[model samples]
Target: MKNNNSNIKLFIDGFKKFQKKHDNILEDTAYTQQPKAMMITCCDSRIDPSLITDTKPGELFVIRNVANLVPPFEGDLRHHGTSAAIEYGVLYLGVTDIIVLGHSNCGGIASLFSNQNKIKSSDFINNWIDIARDAKDRTLDRCKHNSQAEQINCCEKESLLISLQNLQTFPWIKDKIDKKEIYIHAWYLDLASGTIEAYNSDLKEFIPL
Candidate 1:
């Protein structure tokens, strides 16, 4: 909040540059959007899903949150940000493909893996993170002998699968999938190595891209 604090100004400056770069597409996105897909990814500063996917403003509808998480639809009236976006994409936008993207060194997953005590004070953060506890538990149960880093990596990948599974709990999405109208995908981004892997159900593993 000091005069010397420049991140806000830096973002403003970056927006000006971005405006100059993409002013041409502004009109197209302003009137309507026909994005090819929808993506749920982390809120990490380093993970720019659009840039990574080489997509412009209207190409992909995106929902970002801590750890890129999605909770199963409970048929309640609460405002679930991730679920709302998913509904809008599938029901309104008619997005054929939905992707749940996870990244390495994810602070959210890492926090679930390591910092449970620290987040207990914030009710929402604590409860939201509890969604991925199963992923952590599964990874630990299966990889008892692996090192912490390897276990964390396993947890990260598994959590993406968990979200993919959770997507099926939404009736609309499930119906679309059952009728072959839509598809769900899982992607893992290894920021340290700058590579991506896509989940293959047949292979039961992520294949490098």
Candidate 2:
């Protein structure tokens, strides 16, 4: 493994290059962040929402969490990081579109198959991942004959649907969607193929985007 000094140097070098190339872009949007879309995606090291979408900084309001899962809206005072980000994006930032982006080979999603007792030691992961328990159950039931990789892929896509549904559970989000002021979407990123697919509500399937 590389030394921490080298990793820090790599970032410093990369930032120098980025500053030369995008310094003006950053300065233009420094004071005001008026992003048009909000994307809820996995906190996976392999995926960068901005790079994948060819979007620049300030163009996207991104919320990254394990398995890209979104829990149903809860009216409480608890510290809901994901929910708080969504609320800020929609109500404060006025983002017009919300996207739930899921990717292949997600370890977080794969944890759904692990023995619950094994992860009981985890302080928060076990509970956070349970948000997509229904998706895992559906994948197991529908793809029982498939291989483990295939089942994980199925769950990966299905988990996005659950997140999308959870987004609507927020009363403000649902109201905006009903009034046609905001739109919601689900997208899948196939890491192996380097391709993206969007969920078609009318067709009830994912198609190349």
Candidate 3:
């Protein structure tokens, strides 16, 4: 415990405890090769999809990224991890519901308002975050008079809507949606209050769920 090597040993010991639990999870998941639902959620350490949903292993096919932004369908790109995961979940795994889950105090959404290109130091992050730039633009355009906090809140919610729209850009997804084979959902998690809200397309608002 006195040196860096000691710290590494302590970390490994903790990991061993986690591994024991993971082994049981693996056994439970072995029989369920395909998940029934898919979720796209933020890459925040505080937000654990399974824990939040009270789901066990193999219950959800999850794709996580900064701000949970889903890019529009584009064939020009050779590799798209989010889209690839979605395609596999929908087409291969036959997932019926896809949820885009956004959370409060997202660094990626906050960086959208920063003067400097915050992610420039990390090229991949900068480029990936550009996918949700439209949401940021919409927020700025409509909330010019609102407080900074309100604007950020609007952007966070709008980003979920943007991802829902982006989901439609995939022809397969669109077809599944049209056929009622798949359903899309948007959600926002307010960390301060521990309340989760689901978007009501019919009501055109977010409602507590």
For all the candidates, what are their Cα RMSDs to the real structure?
A: 1.9, 2.6, 2.6
RMSD of candidate 3 to true structure, Å? 2.6
lDDT of 2 by residue, 21-107 (tens): 864777778899999899999999998999988998899999999989999999999999999999999999999999999999888
Predicted model with the maximum TM-score: 1
The number of clashing residue pairs in each candidate reads: 0, 0, 0
The model with the greater lDDT, 2 or 3, is 2
Between prediction 1 and prediction 3, the one with superior TM-score is 1
Query: What TM-score does model 2 achieve against the real structure?
Result: 0.92
- C-alpha TM-score for every candidate: 0.93, 0.92, 0.89
Model 1 agreement with the true structure over 90-174: per-residue lDDT tens digits = 9999999999999998877877766434554675776887788999999999998998888889999999989989999999999
Worst 10 residues of 1 by lDDT: 114-123
- The clash number for model 1 is 0
Ranking by lDDT: 2, 3, 1
lDDT of candidate model 2 versus the reference = 0.91
Every candidate's lDDT: 0.89, 0.91, 0.89
In terms of TM-score, how similar is model 3 to the real structure?
0.89
